[model samples]
Each structure stands twice: as structure tokens, then as C-alpha cells.
Target chain A: MGDLTPEVQRIAGNLLSQGQVDLVLGWAKAPSNGQSVPACIRQAEQAGRLIFDQYCIHNLATGLLDHRDSSERIGIFVKGCDSRGIVRLAEDGQFPRERLYIVGICCPGMKDQAACDRAASGLFGETAGDSELAGKCRQCAHPNPVIYDELLGDQQPPFLNDVRFSDVQRIEAMGIGERGEFFSQIFSKCIRCYACRNICVACNCRQCIFDETRPQWVGRSTSAADNMMYHAFRAMHVAGRCVECGECERVCPAGLPLMLLNRKLIKDIDQLFGPYEAGLSLEEGARPPLSSYRVEDPDPFVR
Target chain B: MKSFAKSAITVVLDRLAEQTRTYVPMRDGVTSNFSPWSERRASDLALNSLNTTFSPKGIVFPQTERLYDFAVDGQRADISGTHAETGENILFGARACDRKAFAALDQVFLRRGYVDTNYKARRDGLTVIGRDCLQPGPFCFCDSMGVDPMGADGADVLLHETTEEFGWEPLTEKGQALTLRLNDLLTEKELIRPESAGCRLEVNVAGLPEKLRGMFDSPVWDELSTFCMNCGVCTYICPVCHCFDIQVMNNGSSGCRFRCWDSCMYPEYNLMAGGHNPREGKRDRFRNRFLHKLEFFQERYGSFGCSGCGRCLVTCPHSLNMVLVINRLGEVKVDAS
Candidate 1:
């Protein structure tokens, strides 16, 4: 139940009052009980609203993308997943790295919102049980933020295992028709709310293709065929830049397994090209695996 | 009024399903939606646990529906309505919120000047079998907006769920007609009226719709829209979010005009052909969404559009539901000196 909220407030207040940042973005208690939502604090007095806990599931760094060009620096609280979003933003040169003041919090895996709803009656402390944790957190490779301007609690060790990829392998093991049906069923559940796209830090575009109507790509209908095209195209768009944040799947109202496509691409990148982890740091080669490819890369189709 | 045991309730549904295509709450993977009942795909009669996800408004006002088809060229422009497979559909286990939404939709589609034949064709023979919600879900706030989770607003027949039995009260001609068919399945069980759980979250609905009339130019929209993702989840999940866009699917020689669900939250919803979008900012769009639900619909339909199903509470990525909006706006000093 203990979180470093006091510490977070102290740092954010210091940053905002001393003119270190114009805005301090973090999670705050939601209007409802046992829930938290992303908050944007512009004043030092409002800095008290900043919170860090198991309920801080949103990737705040995505919203920070719009504020990148501001004259004054912006302070952001980042988890392992959110910090990766920062790296992805930096890699694309979407924002100046100097403009950000990152306050990283070591995450002890988070729980699913639905599971949290189910457990709301328990009235208990943070429990790190596998069943309670989000699907992404269960197979997380990084519990500590890969990059941060300031670190909060004691760093937790990363649980490095590749069991998550077997999901992609399991799909790969399926016959083509079965795979088609599998994805069709998932995509059909899409309400086309664009929660996955809107919540994504990597899906930073001035105008999303789905929203464009001049030469409309995806029509405004929730048909299964149209939905399939929308997701398939988005997976290709965020292929390499995706930092395994799992925000897409988390934000999905229909509970469609969106990370399956993103992780499948990540798995392909690792196996086909080489082991590649996105958004580790700006110091690491900024280009995502697909953006800057070597000609010597192996190909099963080209042959 | 006659009550039947939990097991015998299936007998009633089975008899109904024998003739009419019964739309029952069935488990659909991670969520539950109304699916047609069959022998293999039985209904999830644990209606308390299984939510409609959104209300059953889609049954009347569908997500996307084709109006008619016209010629690609100007020649032979006879609008041909799609042939609908004619059959009666019964929405079983429909909640009061869902039934209220059906009535609200009826105002728009049936009672309106130009009755929408597309909606009318489907709604004419349709019937609602209502069930009382004992334990309301995390997001339910139906009672605040003049809706009872236990009341039968649009239902022909109302069923009260208890631990051991379901008390049936046939309300309309449809119910009495259907009851005649369930002659053998009927049982003489005691009608137990236990206390029902309704929406916990409260909003001040009195004089509020009128209050919203002058507050369109308010600053509260800015604060609310700051966290708004402009996603259609809220509108789609909403029971009475009935704004839909008219679009035409064009092939070279053939095309079909259809109506698809649109959100006032989207920028394109207000965009003009002449490149003018009045509600351009997220603030404007956000304000419009609640205003339409509270004020505009009240002006037109004599009631607020929202049924308080609370689908938006659980579904919104950010917890920006009507509860928060109502609370924030209610507290806002409209004439800040």
C-alpha cells in the first residue's frame, strides 16, 4: 500500500516552483473509489495531485508528445512502460530530449483494471499475484525504467524470460485459415473507438489515417472486414517503434488482445533480424529495427 | 402475476425461442452481448453477473444499417430497400435502462415526423422481456436519471429475479399473448419482492438540463476535454448516444447509403462541406456530448438523452464519465465574477 507520493510531490513542486518545468504530468486518484487516472498539473500548488501506485497504469509520456515544443521544460512521471514511450518519442525526433524532466518509478507489476474491479471488495494492499497482474506485466522484461532523470524507490530486478513470444509462436503454429479466423474474431470485437491509437504514445500523428476523410482509407463503420484492415495497418505502422508498452491492449474496451500483433512483430524482428529491444535509451541507436535495416538481413520470402 | 423456478424460466425462453428469435444475454469471450439463442448457444441466465456491455439500444438503433441503394450514375435511380428477413425478436432479460433506451429511441425513430422505415421494420414486431437487476454493476447509475433498474419501461413482460425463483408479470398484449403459449411451463411459486440494488452514483438531474442551456460557453469544457481522448467508446457504450452519420459505400456501378453510429466527440461530426467546423476544439466536442444528453435532448424529447447505464464509466480509458461531468459542472460557478 506504500507509495512514494510524498517524494513525488516534493520533486514536482521543486521543479514547477523553481521554473524547472512548466507542467508536471502524473497519475492522480480517479473520481471513483479504488481507481486512478492520468493527471496534468500545471502549477506547483497542484503538484500535490501527482501520485504513483499500482493503479497508475496510463502511459503519460504519450500526452507529453504534444507539449514537447513548449519553451519551458515539462516534468513527467514514468513507469518502465512509460519511460520506454519517452525513448520511442526521442528516437523519432518528435521531441527534444532536453525539454523533458523524467521522474521514473520502479514498478512492481500492475494489475488489470477488470481484475481490480473484481477485487475492489477485498479492501487490501498491493498484491503481486500472477492472476491479479496484467497479461503484459506477467511477461515483463523490464520492471525498472530504462531511462530516467530521477529514480524513486529501490530498483527492482528485471524478470527476463521469453515465454510471451510462445503466444506468437502458438499463433504461428496454427494453420493459415485458423490464424485468419483468430485475428478476425479479435478484430471483430473492435468498436473502432481508437482508444488503442489515441492512448498510444507511438501513434503520434498530426492526423491519423483512420480519421482522414478526403481520401478515406478506413470507412467509419464497425464491420469485421473494415476493422481487420484498420488493425492490420496500424500494426504495420507501429511495428518497430512499439516499445512493448501494452497500452493498446490495456485501453481496449472490448478486451481485444492487441499486444498480440505488436508482440508478434517484436518477435519477428528479434528472430529474423536480431535481438532488438525498443526504447531502451536515446543513447542506444535511436532507429527502430525496421526503420534502418541492413541489406544482409535474412529473408525467407525473398528467396 | 405468476412466478416460476429458475430452471423453469428456461422453459419459458425455450417456448419463445421455438417461434421467435430470442436475443438473450450470452457470454461473448471477454464481454457479454445479446446473441440469438439456440439449443447449442444457451442464454446466460445469470443476468446479474452478465451485463449487456452497453444497453440493448443496438437492437433498435443498430450500429450500422443500410437505408437503401441508389444508382452510381443518375440514370435508373430507383432506391431499393434491402430485403429484411421478417421475423419477431424478443429481447429477454432486458434491464430497465435498456428498456428506457428503447423508448427514447422510439421517440427518435418512430414518433418523429419522418418515421425511419429501416428502424420501424425491425421494431414493429419486436418485444422486450424485462428482468430486474438485484446487484447493479460498478458503472450503473440508472436511478439518478429517472430510470429504475427494477421498473419495466418498455418491456411487455417484467420478471423479478430472486434467489430461488423469477416472478413474472405480464404487462402488455404481447406478454399476455406470449403467456398463453407458456401454458404448461407456468408454475405457482410465491412472488418474493426482495430489496433491489440500483445505481450507487448520484447526479442532480433536477433543473440541470435547464442549467446546461446557458453554460455551453463555459470553461468547464476545457478542463473536462483535457483528459478526453475523443474516442467513440463513450458514445458507443452509451445507451442513448443516437447521433449517426450518413455515408455511402460506392462501387463503380452500384452503391448503398447507410447510417453508422457517430459521436459528437469527433471533429468530423460537425465539419461542414465548406471547411467550417464550429465545434473544432476538443473542448467544444466534449461539451456538446453532455449537452446533447442533458440539454438538447431535453428540449426535443422532453427528457435527457442519458439513461445512466454507466457503460461509459467502466469503458472510458480515462474515468471521464457523466458522473464526473455532472459533479464538476454542478459545482462550477457559471457566472464567475
Candidate 2:
């Protein structure tokens, strides 16, 4: 990772100098804590601020939405999961592929900044060490980017313990009432901060349902019912489109088991839609299972 | 000095809980916050942690609260204020920074010739028991914000943590009353007051308010807000970022007006009735937040809006925080127009 920074800087500098990109999105060491945070470099000289490290865990794909309304060509760096975000956005027609210069990194997993923060804050009684890999990275099936104009680093294998749907299976094994109780307990802790929704690349709606005031699709209260509605609506909306980046779970301040909900939907989609994974490619006119209808599609819920 | 042994601290809390709904710093799953204490949650008490993940401000000003109830039938309207009397409550083991935030909140909801009935009701009954922050973390900068880690300005009772016992000092009439209630549990003892150790992270806020007053149009806001994703995590988790929106939920004719936490970072925060937004861009919203914390708050109140508990430092997914903003703002050369 240390050796790859020079190449990243060189490529970003070259892109900016040649005016091939209006902006380069990557990670830079935060001056406050020395932790790698998202950096937007518009000038070739500022490209040196960029760095790639294990602590650069934030999914920069969500940041692309800030420029969606503009015609500025963006040069972005992506990990395996983040590349899926590009696919998610491009497929949704929210962003055009022509406006992007994709720089992909063959991710080797990253450490969780929250864990490092908790440990450093001395707030949690005992927290995971800074060196611990993020829980999301542990379940990653793709360590290499699916799409990129130019790639960095060597490709890597899937993480050791790929129990992607194991947690979903455990929840599925629970009885109906117990599962309801489990979900309610977790949902009750939600503060309605919307960090999970805001951080998700798949949530690219011009006007989110939760924010609609005219119809008020979801109640704003942090009550059990409202929280459930918020999460359930969000999960259903992003069911087949979610790239399994595990970012929603990672950014949740309440520590809710959001991946359980997301992975459960993914597993169901795979079963019903016959082995499908989202954000895997940029096929022309291809749509997620939930987005496009098929004549042979199962309609178990419709009946 | 009246003191209680560290082992008997729970006994003190047990007695306090009998009198009022006691809120204590407790671990909740992956995070810690002030929650109503019970025997079952006694094991989760995190007195020695740097600061709770969430601030204890919700004890007085909740995240959501009903302002009024209204019913409209046949062109006749019946409206009732939902100003229920908040019963006695105790906030135990709050640090100086959090306690200072209560003072900042007090200025907004209680002072300036206008009073919020709901905030006043809850605040009047609330007794704050501020504990000394002996273990300042890497992110803490309360001292830089003019807060003393050893002294809590508005706390009724101050609990000084030592190796074996807590040296309790009653500072107000309310503190005295609580001291009398726990007389049996406490014993007179002489203990060394812990040395006040300030935070490792320090920012010079001197002349910051004055400098920020005229720098609203500074280009620094653009650079600072470049990577900010405009999430509500910082404001919602902040102890003193007390912005809210009043909304109503109507089921046909009967509805209740409620207020919930709102963030300036959101696009809808500044949306006007005419469908025009003043602070429409991320840079505008971001600049307003930093100014409010540094300049506007000081002009409106006497002190800074931020208590510097550094909650945003840890929780912001993008790493955009007050410390970074302050440092960048201080470094930039601006004309004091």
C-alpha cells in the first residue's frame, strides 16, 4: 500500500494536468488525526495529498452524487465493492459512464476507522484494536474491481471466511415471533440520523421516500414503528440494487445489524432470480431483478 | 468531605434512583450513552470511559417531543399544549464538557426573555451530577474550549473519582438536598483531589469568533466542505448543535405537532415556503455550521456553541470534524471586513 501511493499520485496528477478530469476523488491523511479521509483534488499539485492505505475504508462512491448534476468529468478511485457503486449509479441513469475516469484498486481489506476511534477515544470499555479488519471486509467476495479504465495493485482472492449469508441463515432459523422481537430490539435503537441511508451509494433517489413531506412516506419519529418502516422501506428499495458494500452497516451509529437485512434480501433475490449479484458489470440496458420484469419471473408474493 | 467507597457507588445510585429517574452513562451494544439506570444495566455503567458516544442532552431536550395536539372537526379546531410536567430526574456521572453543553442549551431554550415551556419543565427538575474527566482521550479538547475538566460550572453536585472512593462536593441547594438523602451511604473522609489533566488535542480558539465574523465569504469553506457528505451524524450526535424542525402527523382531523432533530447539513433545512433555499450548497451549509459554533453562537451567547466533547471526531464517516475545520480556518489568511 505504501509503495502504491506514488503510482496513485502520479496517475491522479497526470489526469488533472492533462485536463482529463475536472476532479480526482481519493483518500488523504486527515491533518487532525492522521487517519485517511476522502479527498477531492482538482489541481495536479494537490494530487500529492492522496494516499491509499488500510485505514482508507470509506466508500468514496457515495461522494460522486455531489457532482451528479454537473457536467464535470470525475476521476474516481474504487475498491471492489465501490466499483459496484459505480455500476449501481450508472445503471440507475443517475450518472453517465462517459463522465467518469475510473481508477480501481484490488482491495486487500481495510481496518475499521470506527473501531480505531472507539479504542482511541477510551469511551468503549474494550474495543477492537486499530489493526482489526473491518467486519464488512471479512465477508467480501470480490477483492478486485469489476470495472476500471486503469487498475492498481495485484488482484487478491476472496476473504478467508466467506460466510456471506450465514448471519441471514441464523436469523432465518429463528421462529417468527422471536425474529420479530430481534428486529424490533435492534430497530428501537435507531436515532433516525440517516447516516446509513446517506452513506449508501445505491440510495441515489432525487427525493428519498423518507424525506418526502407531501406524502410523508415514513414517519420521522424514532418510535419502534417508524424505525421499522424506515429500515424496511430502505431495504426493499435497494433490495436487488445494493452492491453488498456493507457500508450501511459500517456507518450506522446505533450498531444495528443492517447487513442482516441486506444480505437476507440478497439471498432471497439469488434464490428467486436464479443466482444474481448486483453491481458486477456495466452491461448495456441491463437492469437489476427488481427493476425490470421478466415473463418467467416468480410472483409468489403477488398471488 | 462526604465520600462513598467505589464498591458502594451502586448503592449511592440505588438510593438516588429511588428518588428520581436516574440517568447514567452505560454501554449499549457497540456504543455508550446516558440511559435510565436499572439493576439489570448496572453492569453496563461506564464511569471511567472518556465520554459517552452520545451526549446526555436528550435528558432535557429529547430527540423528538410533542409540542401540542390538535383536532379539527367541521371548521372547529381544538388545540391543547402538551406541556406535561417532567418529574424529578438525575443525570449522574456526566463529564464537564457534557455539563457545559447543558449551559449552552440553557442559553437557547431558557434565556433571552423567551422560554420554551417543555425545555424549561424538564430542565428545572433535572439535577446534574458532573464527574471529573480524569482520562482525557486523544480527541478531547474541552479545555481548549475554556472548559475545566475538574470543575463543572452548572452541575449541582461534583463527583471526584479517585482510586478507592468518590469525593462528593455539593455546590447548590439541590445538591445539598441530594446529599442529605444519601447521608447514610456517605462517610466523611479526606481524599486527594485528582490533578486536572487537560486534553492532548488542543486548538487555539483565541480571536476565532472575531476572525470568523467577517470571513463568511472566505474561500476556505469550499475547500473544507469538498469531501463533506452532508450527513446528520455530526449534528445529531453533537451535544450542542440544537437545531430542530416542527412537524405534524395528521390522521384525518386529529393530529399532533411534534419537533424532531434537524440538521443544517440537509438540503431541506433551509427550504422556505416560497421554495427558495438560502443555504442551498454544501459549502453554504458547512460554513454556517462552523460559524454557528465559532462566531454566531458567541455573539448570541457569551461562549462557544461547541463543548468540544469531540463526538463528531469519532462518528463522522467522512472525517470532517470541528477540530479539522477550526485548524483550517485558523490557518487561512482572511480580511476582517
Q: Quote the lDDT for A32 in model 2.
A: 71
Query: After superposition, which runs of candidate 2 have C-alpha atoms over 4 Å from their true positions?
Result: A160-162, B72-83
Q: What Cα-based lDDT does every candidate model obtain?
A: 0.78, 0.89
lDDT of candidate 1 over B240-331, digit per residue (tens): 77889988787768878888898887777888888899987777888888888888889999977888776777667777888888887788
Evaluate every candidate with DockQ and list the scores.
0.38, 0.68
List model 1 lDDT by residue over A1-303, tens digit each.
Answer: 366989999999999999988888888886545467888888999888777777677788888765655676889899898999988888887777788999989888776664455233111112124356676676678878988899988877665455668778899999999999999988887888788988888898777888788988887778888899999999999988898888888777677889889989998888777678888878745588788868897766875
What value does the lDDT take at residue A61 in candidate 1? 86
> Residue by residue across B110-133, what tens digits does model 2's lDDT show?
998899888899999999998888
lDDT of 1 at A260: 87
Candidate whose lDDT is highest: 2
The most accurate candidate by DockQ is 2
Assess candidate 2 and give its lDDT: 0.89
